[model samples]
Target: MIRMFIRDEAGFVVSAELVLIATILILGLIVGLSSIQHAIVSELNDIGVATGNSNQSYWYTGFSSEKDFANGGFSAYTRGSAGNDTQDDCDNDQCDISCDVPVNEGPKSL
Candidate 1:
């Protein structure tokens, strides 16, 4: 029976065809997946570059700061504040500094 089956050769042809088809399919899938991944990475990189190069700075409009409020709790050093401003000092960044600069004392929340 084994010798007869081996002599047939039809099954071998079918198996070879299946192997070829499977290889083609796998190769196609790999190429497609690679392309998709590359495209996504490129898009993400573009987004990152755009985000990084974006101008997230706020224009210097003006500010409303009281030199004295809540006792004399002020120092001569404060980030994004007057040289003599305390942590409690008024700053446009009461919310977020990204959309805040120069201090627009009008509307607080945007």
Candidate 2:
């Protein structure tokens, strides 16, 4: 019986068909999974590229705008007085009387 079973070629075609079907399924699965992975990687790369582009294109000259608050000759300016008065009393007498008097000093140093 064992020898007859070993020598039988009845299920040879069925085994070949099963192997062919499994190989085709495995190849299809590998191709489909690789395509999905490629697509995901491409999308992530695009997102990264977009981020980099936006960052690079961003321009900020300064935090605030340049404003000139200069007063172009129209500011609140007032003219000074005329001059000086040459007729003033100095101490208890006239300004030119004892104006050149020197103070009392100690001994002079060598």
Candidate 3:
């Protein structure tokens, strides 16, 4: 019985198959998660752009009214200034260093 148990190969193939399936699953999960990360970043950047493009300027005119023999009421005008959105200097497309040299190039006389 001991020898037969030791020689049994029936479960060996199942174990190998399980390992292969798990490896494949893990690899696919990694790829899927990377894609999700990229999509989320893209969406967030779009939201930032949309927010930057929104206009908040507004204005309202004054009003006044008079009665038979008296001054009734009056309101002053109001306005808000608006400005164009400037390009971000540190945006993703321009944030990377253009040169191959390291930022902290060790002392020249090292």
Alpha carbon deviation, residue 99, candidate 2 (Å): 99
TM-score of 3: 0.49
Please, what are the lDDT tens digits per residue for candidate 2 over residues 1-109?
9999889987646578899999999999999999999999779666755554442223223233334456334334444434432322332232232356688999999
True-vs-predicted CA distance for residue 41, candidate 1, Å: 1.0
| lDDT-based ranking | 3, 1, 2
CA deviation > 4 Å runs, candidate 1 = 1-14, 58-110
TM-score, every prediction: 0.42, 0.38, 0.49
lDDT of 3 by residue, 1-110 (tens): 99999888775455788999999999999999999999998897777666655654555454444343355443443444555555566543444445676687577783
Best model per lDDT = 3
The ten-residue window of minimal lDDT in model 3 covers 65-74
Off by over 4 Å in 3: 1-14, 68-110
In model 2, the Cα lDDT at residue 19 comes to 92
lDDT of 1 at 31: 100
Residue pairs whose backbone atoms clash in candidate 3: none
